[model samples]
Target: MKIEVNVKKRYFFALLGILLVLGGVFAVYAYNSNPPNPRVFGHTINEVDGITCNSGQAVTRTAAGWSCVNIASSGGSTPVNPVNTLSYFEDFIDRGDTSEVNHPGIISFQGYAGKTFGYIHSKDMFDITFLVKGNGTLYGLSSYESFYVGLVDASVSSRIYFFISGGNWQAGTRNGGSTKVTNLNTGVSIGNSPEWFKLRIKRVDAGTIEFFINDASVGTINSNVPVMPMQIFAATPGEADGRLHVLIDYIDLKITNLAR
Candidate 1:
């Protein structure tokens, strides 16, 4: 009887010890899996930008004329990224704005606070086509993308297009074998150098669209509504002409549904 009692106690202690160890492990995993949210960097913003670049330093051709700009954010539940550079006169391209970027870099400004952009990446297919200029590296399409919200009052419309290689190899577009832009999905073409280029994304009536480079229609998209892709982005893939310099101007977005 004494031996039996001792054996039972030992088994209970061993089981309890194992359970405690597992619990600790689970706690650690939970903590590690969930990273903390991003906190505001500081009390004030101190970054320069080229948000609304001048019309023609590098843009000799109409299709290559693009004014680039840097982006910013507000800590007080403020809007960042998806900036309405043309809509709000305050957002301008500094002509001297460069910064680091990554996926999900944009947070919704006009929407309710806490609205953030997710990786609405394109599939291996489902793309529009575009053209490239100058000999340089042309990176792959971004499965992830951006979209702009056009506030319309009872449904207004605009024409949109895209050009990948005119403004100093600073644009991206997607296309299939056809040079037609509408058939492509995404394209990001550029070279690593200080060059000026032109690109146009014209959205027409929320349906017919065109992508132009240097005033030439390189591609077009025919859908029920315009793409109005809110974000323009690229990832550095391993390649030859290894270095690249890319830029994106503004998409001429027209609104029909206005609150006023």
Candidate 2:
């Protein structure tokens, strides 16, 4: 009888230990399956209920954790791939130009015939867009008079620029102070009046540059594209007839795939 009692006591302890191990496994499973609110010092901590995402992104939960994702539109549009981009925009409503013209929605640059007026100095190369128009017509003065809008390097020698000279629209680029210029004369004449023209310059790749006017593709330059960092510049080199001024509606720069 003493032996049997000792054996029974051992069985009881063994059964208790087995139950404890099973309970621990079940607790771990439960925690992983539906994790309870995190606790600290015996107090339940508040968890973030929602997260904010950028323009084309949404918050979602994956197996590992919560993260941001690009979401599709409700209209069944294709999902846009996410890209890292830096952008800058100026409408000139609150900013003043060298002319100090306190207009409601425009910035004016009025200067002498030989001088250049620049607005924004960007840190690097960017896809640029601007709305601009000159004050008067100085056609047939291509050699001496022009209005320039686009990217230019610090020395003003290397650039990818769009210019209207002698009422003709042209896209040109110069590399490393080389006098040889790659020009695309669009043959489309632009009048120097109050009407604004939308001009865009986009760097397609390391070797290509695209130009657009009023949302139409005018030309592309495959060579002579400046590789150096450039600034957004607009200059009105006045004609011999009178002082030239430029009125700008806005300027926007979108930078992607920055150089390392």
Candidate 3:
């Protein structure tokens, strides 16, 4: 009888130890499976933080959650890479003056006194197609009334200026102090009426830059100096009290192998 009692006691203790071991395993598995939510950087913004975007940018809601897009400007939330083809399109249907750009290494000025001038950029691509509609009075003082679209570098030279002045169209490339101006077509007029125009600028080989308007070859610019296009921009230059505007329909860019 004494032997049987000792055996029963041992069995009970063994069962208890098994239950304790099972319970510990279950606890560890539960803890690991249900970890804490992740946080964003140093901010208090947890995974629950809502969507956010900067100037010249747009955001949309998706079934999974929030999604953001860099609309028309390369300066938006998306980074620019020019080794490949990059294109941007905008209708200006929403967010008027508030839709500005804050591209690095460029001045930040949206609309002042009801006139707008802004820039968009890509990586290092030289071939580009700039298309837009000129609407409303393109303002200016008497001698200097113009609206411009072209490429600009950190300095003034190494820049191409395609503009309309006093109802005449002009194309010019600048190299430091001197600017070579060419009258592509004369009597090209744009006023308050909405008129669509296109400027296609391409670098052919190492010494020549080709210009096109409305798919027609207007002229070519040959330069002995190497010019690297940094940013694609549009500006209304002058001092007219009238408010000016331009409708950006689309801009298509690609790095072409035609030079080779």
Per-residue C-alpha lDDT of model 1 across residues 85-185, encoded as one tens digit per residue: 21211122222223322211112121121111111112111122212212123432221122222111111232122323332222222232224223343
Error of 1 at 118 (Å): 14
Q: Give Cα-based local distance difference scores for all models.
A: 0.30, 0.53, 0.45
TM-score per prediction, in order, is: 0.27, 0.51, 0.46
Clash pairs detected, candidate 3: none
Q: RMSD, each candidate, Å?
A: 20.2, 20.4, 19.0
Candidate 1 segments whose C-alpha is farther than 4 A from its true place:
1-194, 224-242, 249-260
* lDDT order of candidates, top first: 2, 3, 1
Judging by TM-score, tell me the better candidate of 1 and 3: 3
lDDT of 3 by residue, 1-260 (tens): 99999999999999999999999999999877733332111111122133334333333334664454443333222322221111221222122223223211111112321111223232223556655453344442122354566776555445665776666566666654355433354344554444456667776656667777777777776643335534556554333332333333334555422120
- Number of the top-ranking candidate, with TM-score as the measure: 2
- State how far residue 2 of model 3 sits from its true place (Å): 88
Residues 109-208 of candidate 2 have per-residue lDDT tens digits of: 4432112223332333356676665544443324334567677776778778887655678898988776757989977677544355677887776688
Off by over 4 Å in 2: 1-105, 112-125, 137-144, 239-243, 257-260
Q: In angstroms, how far off is 3's CA in candidate 1?
A: 99
Residue 160 lDDT (model 3):
66
Give me the runs in candidate 3 sitting further than 4 Å from their true place.
1-125, 137-144, 179-187, 224-226, 238-242, 256-260
